[model samples]
Target chain A: MIGCYDFCGHYEWTFEWLSQLGGHTLVRAYWDEAVHQDSQTHASKLIREKGFEGMKEYWGPTLADEGAVYERTVTDDVFRIDMHECPSKGFLLRNGLEQYRDYCDHCMGWIGPLMKDAGFVIDHEHNHCGQCWWEIRRKDDATPASAAGELSGASDVRLRPGWQSPHTDHYERSTDPDDKTVVS
Target chain B: MASSIPASLPYADTKPAGHADFYFAVNATFRFILRHHGEGALRKYWQDIGQSYYQPVSKRWSELGFAGVAEYWRAFFAVEPGAEVEVSEAQDEVRLEVKTCPAIRHLREHGREVVPNFCQHCFFVNEAIAEPAGMTVRVCGGNGSCTQRFMKATADLPPQNLEDIATAS
Candidate 1:
C-alpha cells in the first residue's frame, strides 16, 4: 500500500509526475483544486469564516503534529510565522528527494488561493533549505512585510545564519505562487 | 516514537509517524486525477509511482526475496499511526492481515470522502512493485480491513478479481 509514512516523498514525486503529464497548469490546478479546495477544506473554511484567528486554530496543532520547529506571531492586523525548520521540506531534504522544480511553492500554491478567497494577502519567502517566513494580512491593509526581527523579534527566521540563499523565493503582498521573485 | 527507523524502509525521517492530515491530500489527489484525467490515468499514476518512486524497495525485495517483503511491510506499518496489521512469513508466501488501515481510519475519522476505488491502489501498486522482484500480490477485502498475500511468480495463484476488494466510502 502507498502508506502516509513517506507521504512527502511521494507527494513531491507526484508533483513532478503531474507536471510531466500536463505541465505547470495541471500542477497549479492540482494544488488549488486538490490541495486548497479538497484536501485542506478545513483550513479554507477556518480562514474563510474567522480570518486571522482561523490561521492560529489551524496551524498551531497542525505544525506541532508535523514536528515543525517554528514560531507564530499574531496581532489584530496580521498573522506571522517564522519557520526555522519546516517538517515536510526537512523530510524531503533529509531523504534527498526533489522531484518538482520548487517544492516550497506548494505552500503558496494552496495557501495563497485560500487566503485570496478569504480576503487576505501574504508576504512570504522560502530558502529551499527548510527555512521560511510568512506574514499574512488583510488585502486592503496595504502594509508591507515587516523587517527582520521586527515582528517576531529574535525568533525571526531572517536573522538566522544561512537563511539567505541564491535560490530564495520571495513574494510581496500577494496571493499567487507565481508572484515570487528569486533573490540571490 | 521509535528513535530509529527499521532498516527495511528506504527513506528516513526525524519523526516516527507521519502527519495523518496527509491522507486527506492522497484522497484529494485521487479525486483530482479521476475528475480530470479519468480512472485509467489514475491507475497509471499508481503503477508509475510503484515502479519509479518505489524502485529502491523493489530492488531490495529482488535481492532479499520473500523475507525482504515481510520485513518491509512490518517496518512500513510500524510508523503508520493507527495501523493494526499482522505480517506472517511462511516458506511459500508472506501474508498481511490488516485489521485497521491507517489511511482509511484517519480519512474516515475526519469525514473525508474516500475514493470508491481506493483499495485497488494496493493491488496495482503492489503488483508493480512485486513484478520486478519476481513475485505477485493479491489483496482481498478493503474499506477498513483487508488481507494481502505476497508469493513468488511461480506460485499457482489465481489472478486477483477486482470485485474481491471492497469499495471505500
Candidate 2:
C-alpha cells in the first residue's frame, strides 16, 4: 500500500520518475492536471468562489494540519504568507530525500495555474532550505511584492538570517512556474 | 522526529501522522498515468517505485526476514491516520489483515473519485519489494480492506488473479 505517512518522499520521487519517463513537460503537466485540477480541485473551488478570503480559508487549516511553521498576512488587496519551515519540504530535508531537481517549483506549478484561473498573480521566492514568501494580488492591482517587513511586519521570512541562498528562486507578478529567476 | 519514528520505517517525518489530503494526489497520479500512458506504464511505475524508492525496506526485510515485514507494517500503519490493520507473523509468513485502508477511507470520506485499478498497486508494489527479499506476496480483496500474505517463494503457491482484487470506485 502506498500510504500517506511518507507521501512527500514518494511524491518527490515520482516527480523525478515522471521527468525521467517524459521530461519536464510531463512533470509540468502532472502538476497542472494531476495536482491542480484533480488532486486540489477543492482548493481551486475555494479560491474561485471566495478569492482572497478563500486563500486564507484554504491555507490556514491546511498548513496547520501539515504542521507548518508559517505566518499569513491578509488584506483587501492581497494575501501574503511567510513560510519559516515548510512541512513538505522540511520532511524531505529531514529525511535526506531529493529526487526532483527543484522540489519547490511544485508549489508554483500547481498554485500558479489555480491563481491564474482565479484572476490573480503571485510574487514568490523560496530558498531551497525550506523558507519562502508569497504575495498574491489581483491581476489588475499592479502592486509589486511587498518588501521585507513591509506587509507582515517582523514576521516576514525574508528578515530571517540566511534567508537568501545561492539556490533561491524568485518570481515577480507571475502565474507560471517557469517564470522564476535564480536570485544568486 | 527521528527519535519518535520506529526503526522499521525507511523514512521519518516531523509530524506523527501524515496529511490525509495527500491521498488525493495519490489517486490523481494514478488517473493521470492511466489516462496518458496506459495500464502497463502505470504498473511499471508502481513496480519501479517499489523496487527503487523502497530499496531500503527490501534490504531490511532481506536482513530480518518475516520479522522485518511485520515490524515495518506495524510501524507504517501506526502513523497512517484512519488505518485499522492487524499484522501477524509466523515461522514461514507475515500476514496483514487490513480492516480499513487509510487512503481509501480518506478519499471516500472527501468524495474523491478513486481510480478503478487503485487496489492493484498493493500487489504490484509489494511484489516488487518482496522479490529482492526472496519472498512473495499475495493480496486478496481490496477497495477498502484486504488480506496480504507475505512468504517465501514456493512452487505450490498459485499466481495471483487480478479479479480477486476489487475495483475502487
Worst 10 residues of 2 chain B by lDDT: B1-10
Alpha-carbon deviation at B21 in model 1, angstroms:
1.2
Residue lDDT tens for model 1, B1-169: 2249987998888887878898999999999999999999999999999999999999999999999999999999998889999999999999999999999999999999999999999999999999999999989999999999998887476888999999999
Q: TM-score for all predictions?
A: 0.98, 0.99
Q: What is the per-residue lDDT of model 2 for residues A61-153, given as tens digits with 9 covering 90 to 100?
A: 999998899999999999999999999899899889998999999999999999999999999999999999999999999888887899999
Candidate 1 docking classification: medium
Quantify how close model 2 is to the true structure by its C-alpha RMSD in Å: 0.9
Q: Of the candidates shown, which would achieve the greatest TM-score relative to the real structure? A: 2
Interface RMSD of candidate number 1: 2.0
Instruction: Please report, as a residue range, the 10-residue window in candidate 1 chain B with the lowest summed lDDT.
Output: B1-10
Best by DockQ: 2
Candidate 1 residue pairs in backbone clash: none
Off by over 4 Å in 2: none
Candidate 1 displacement at residue A73 in angstroms: 0.7
Off by over 4 Å in 1: B1-3
